[model samples]
Target: MDDARQPGRAYRGRRRAQAAHTRYAAVLTTAVVGAGIVALGVSTALPEPRNDLSLEASGNFDDVSVRGGTDRAGRSRTSNPMSNMPAPDVWILPMQRYTLTSFYGERWGRLHPGVDLGAPQGTPFTAVAAGKVILCGWNGGYGNNVMIDHGDGIVTVYGHASKLLCKEGQLVKAGDRIALTGNTGHSFGAHLHFEVREHDKPIEPLAFMRKHGVDIQKHTEAIYG
Candidate 1:
C-alpha cells in the first residue's frame, strides 16, 4: 500500500511542475508580443528628417507688410537663388534692383559713412547676413534705422526706413526682410542708407561685399538668372 501511494504522489508532483512551466511560457510570450507592439508604435510616431540649411519664410515677415515670392518676370524670389555663389557666410543683396545714389566718403563738410541706395518709398530691403538686431528705432540722423550685429565685430546698418520690420534683440538671417526704403531723418529722398562697420567704424561697403564674393553693383537684379 505504501509503495502504491508513493507512485501516485510522484505523478501528482509532476503534474504540478508541468502546470507552472505552462504558465511561465504564456507570460513570456505575452511579454514579447507587447514589446514588439510598443516598438512598432514608436517607429510609426517618429517624424521624417528635414534639411536644416534649406531656406524658408519666417513668421516674422508675415507679421509685417513686405514684398516677396515671385517677381514681375515670374522669377522665384524666396528660394536660395544664390546658393551656388561662394561666400564666407550666406549673404544677399538688400534689394533686387536699386540705384546707388551716394557712396561712402566726404559729403559737403562732414563724413558720409554709408551708401545711399535709391528705390521706391515702400520697397523692401533684406539683411545681408545672419545676425542679431542691436539697434532698431529712430537713431537721430539715421531715422527709423535698424542695425544688425553680425559676429566678429561686424555690424550692418539700414537707415532711413519708412517702416521697420524688425525689433531690438531679434535674430535675422540673410535675405530676411528688415525694413522698407523711405526718406526719413536726414535723408533727402526715398532710399536705403546701407553701412558696414567694423568695431563701430564704417568701411567701404561695396569693396567689403565684393571681397566676400558678392558684387553689389553687378548682382543688383535677381540672385539667379
Candidate 2:
C-alpha cells in the first residue's frame, strides 16, 4: 500500500511542475515580442537622415536654394550678378581752356604729375564728377588747392586756384564750379592744374577723362578752333 501511494504522488507532482513551466514560457515569449515591437515603432518615428550637407554651415540643411551649389568644376559657387556691371556715368570737362600748357610727365628735370590748362584768370573751373570735397585750403606747393573724392578710390585734385568756391565736406554735383583759374602756386601764368589720382597715384588726366566718356580731344578742338 505504501509503494502504490508513492508512485501516484510522484506522477501528480511531475504534471504540476510541467504546467507551471509552460505558463512561465508563454509569459516570457509575449514580453520579448512586445519589447521588439516598441523598439521598431520608436525607430520608425524618428526623422530620416539627410544626404545633402550644402546648407549645414547656415543650419538650414533642409532648405535647398538655387543660388548656392556646385559649379561645372565641382567647386562651390556663390552668386554675384552685378560684379561685372559698368560703373555709373557721371563725366564732364573740368574747365574750358585756351591751350594745353604742360603735360603730365617729366618737366624741367622733375615730374610734373598733372596737366596744366591755360585759361583766363578768374574763369570758373568745375568738378569732373559728383563727389564730396575732402580738402580745400592753401597747400604749400599747391597753393590754394581743392581735392574731391569721387568714390571707388578715385580722387580729383585742383591746384593753384585763385579762389575756392566749395568748402571742405561740401557735396557737389558733376560740372559744379569748385574753383577759379589763377597763377597761385609755382606757376608762370594764369592756368588750372588738374590731376586725377587713383589710390594716391597720379594718372594722366586726359586719358582718364576720355576713358570715362568725356571727349577731352573734342573739347580742346572745339575751344581752339
Candidate 3:
C-alpha cells in the first residue's frame, strides 16, 4: 500500500508540472502577439516617403520624354480638354486709360496672379475682347468681378469693381463696359486688376500678348490715333 501511494503521488506531481508549463507557453505567446500588433500599428502611422522634384528638375518635369507627357513605352501624351482657342488671338486693354501700377511676374511680397491697371474710382471698365461671361458677380476677395471664358483654354478675369453690370453667361464685346473700377474686394487703391490664364496658369501678360501679335504699345498708339 505504501509503494502504490508513492507512485500515485509522483504521477500527480508530474501532471501539475506539465500543466504549469503549458500555461507559461500560452502566456508567452499572448505577449508576443500583442507586441507584434503594436509594432505593425506604429509602422502604419508613419508618413509615406516621397521624392520632391528639385528646382532645376522642375523645368524638365513637363518634358514629353521624362515625365507623364508620354505613354508607358514612348507614345505621345494627349492633353485632355485640349485648347480649342484660336491661337490666343485677341487684343486686350484695361477699361480705363491708366498707368501700369503693377505688372505680372512681380513679387509683390506675395503671389501676384495678375497685372494691375491703375484707374481712378468709377472709371468705366470694359471687356478686353469678345467673350462669353463665365462669371459676373461678387466673389470672395473679388468684389463685383467678371470672368470671361473665350474658349480654347484661354480665360480673362477682371476684379475689384464698384458695380457689376453684366450678368453671368452674357456675351461681351471688346471695349464694352462691363463694370466700374473701384477699391473693392481686396485692394489698396482704385485699380482695374486683370488676369489672363492659359489652362489656369498665369504667365507674363505683356509678353504673352506680344507673342499673340497683339501689340502692347498699340494701347498708347490707339489712344493717340
Arrange candidates by TM-score, descending. Answer: 1, 2, 3
Model 3 lDDT, residue 123, Cα: 79
> Which 10-residue window in model 2 sums to the lowest lDDT?
38-47
**Residue 180 error, candidate 2, Å:** 0.7
lDDT of 1: 0.57
Specify the poorest-scoring 10-residue window by lDDT in model 1.
38-47
lDDT of 3 by residue, 1-225 (tens): 011111222122112212323433533443344322110000001012112421211222133123222242122122212223221123445442566887665353444667787777877777765566656766545566777655545667787888787875465555556888888766779887787767645556776666643444344212112
lDDT of each: 0.57, 0.55, 0.51
Better of 1 and 2 by TM-score: 1
- Give the clashing residue pairs of candidate 1, or none: none
TM-score (C-alpha, index-matched) for candidate 3: 0.56
What's the residue-level lDDT of 177 in candidate 3?
A: 69
* Full ranking by lDDT: 1, 2, 3
Q: State candidate 2's TM-score.
A: 0.58
Q: What are the RMSDs of all candidates, in order?
A: 30.8, 43.3, 34.4
